[model samples]
Target: MGRKVCQQDHGQSRQNSNGHSNDHLFSTHVQAVIVQLSRPVLRPGFRPDARLWRGGIEGNFEVTISMYDASVGLFVPYLRNLSALLDKGVAYAEARKFNPAVLLGMRMAPDMYDLAQQIGEACRHATVAAALLADREPVALPVLEHDMAGLQARIATSIEFIESLPRAEINAAAERNVFFRLKNGTELPFTGRTLLLTFSVPQFFFHVTTAYDLLRHAGVELVKKDYLGRR
Candidate 1:
């Protein structure tokens, strides 16, 4: 039953006899738990205490991924990978007996942001997207330094902030409209889903890829696995 529901890519929910739609309860990444609710029928906003399970109905439930699973789930893992890439940078610089700051200041183009700024921007995109979805204020980032500790701290702070958001709030914000403000006072608008899928996720990856490219160009000895991270 769980395997069949998990294989459904449409993510559509089935209406129960009591007219409750278990939309939010199902997730593609199903845990190995079976729960049966018999007394009271499923209703709207009714969530099981478990994180996300794939059992209950005899065979009617459909598995669907949540908004939080799509957005924050993607950000947190890649952010950790970014931090590990920085660690490799520090190690490479130490072995070469040169200042790691040189690598941080490296950029692919003269007109582009340097490595430190690239890291900062990546962190910003992730945190900002998570905050907007969760309906909370993003953490005020300090000026980033072109040093190993400063770069690592920025990544750590970003990971902490995004991980601290309430999952339910982010899930509820799926269709909410969000505004992205630029430095020149231009505000771009997007619905929560569009914000993650189009704007923020792409922006985050661009900065992170730029940072990795800068480090690699400076001889940091990173492999493809370093960027993809461990499963």
Candidate 2:
């Protein structure tokens, strides 16, 4: 017997080809979620919502621009952690009758930067990242922070520096070319988007995580929650 019948969707499986492809609908929905959460594209003036794109796309330049802010945003927590942990670490060392300087100077590897340098580098990256993203001149890296108080001040200063920029200036940088010198003393230019996603953001996190690792390796009682400051 030859037959054709409309089947109602009960939400059991994603595939429904009777009238429309539920499989396609579900697949597109998942892809959109991934883009919004992780892999956002940088397209100036391109709206992210479904109403505008009409293809279930889920992000825009604004979302990508927000990454710069979020890059700085993540540093906020890093700074706070460093502040609290530095105090706690000092106390821990005092309790054990060990000089805190030894712990502060320790690194997971001999070839790597020490805790003070790690914290300084993290702050420096944040400062430079915000300036480049906003298309402004970077503030000169402050004199290297030595003590815990100096480190905390450096972090706070970086945050203040980033927050001082106008959002419009940062957003306007989507099309701007940002020139930066490589370690080899040669300059490499990048569009603001590439600079953030490829260079600044990664460098910021690398130092942050390294700072965290330095603290944890030195036996500071910092859990993962300490790494990611909560709301």
Candidate 3:
């Protein structure tokens, strides 16, 4: 007798060689498995079906991570940590007998955005991505205020907006098409997943990290934990 493995087909089950029904296997989650056998059962152009599986003898399995988990799960914490990070900037300014607003003008390079702009971009990326995925208009950028409190308020507004989006709507947008328009009036097209993963998240983090670096370079004391927050 040949060794038999379980396969799922539209919720129906068949018995294996051991006379046990295989319906229970992979019934609970989305997964892809590549079994290691004498012969490769995964053929060329093999794709995950409705069940998200390709079967053969003993193989490897892949799990589907959700879009919601990838997007909001990341943006919220980092935005919160970003807010906390700015608070440290305020403290550093106070202790050194300088205006906290001074730090917002610091940047690593002359061509780059200063600390205030970086924070604004970070908040913009987070909120825009969430709004796009939720099928809503993104929050408009307010007039740039030169104060630390103003920047902090921007972060607060972003957090509130991102948290207000429905998780289900965002999750369902994984395959939806969205266009990103650049300042030059060029529109770039992307699916929701690609927009968030490839563009939005990366852009968001770049500005956030730049903001952190600006403060550190300006003599504000910050550790990695300040960036990561309580994990």
lDDT of 2 at 172: 55
TM-score of each: 0.76, 0.67, 0.73
Best by lDDT: 1
Which residues of candidate 1, in runs, are more than 4 Å off? 1-62
Give the Cα-based TM-score of candidate 2 against the true structure.
0.67
Alpha-carbon RMSD to native, per candidate: 8.9, 13.1, 10.6
| Candidates' C-alpha lDDT | 0.80, 0.66, 0.77
Backbone Cα, N, C clashes tallied per candidate = 0, 0, 5
Q: Whose lDDT is higher: candidate 2's or candidate 3's?
A: 3
- Where is model 2 more than 4 Å wrong at Cα? 1-68
lDDT of 2 at 155: 75
Report the C-alpha lDDT of model 3 over 1-231, residue by residue, as the tens digit.
Answer: 234533225345555333434333443332333322223347886543432233422233433456766887788889999999999999988998998998888878899998998998898889888998999998776888878888888998888888778776887788999888876999989999999889999998898888888888887899988887886
Task: Give the per-residue lDDT of model 2 (tens digit) for 13-111.
Answer: 443212333234334665666556453458876545534452323222112224434555555666676667677777878888987777668887899
Model 1 TM: 0.76
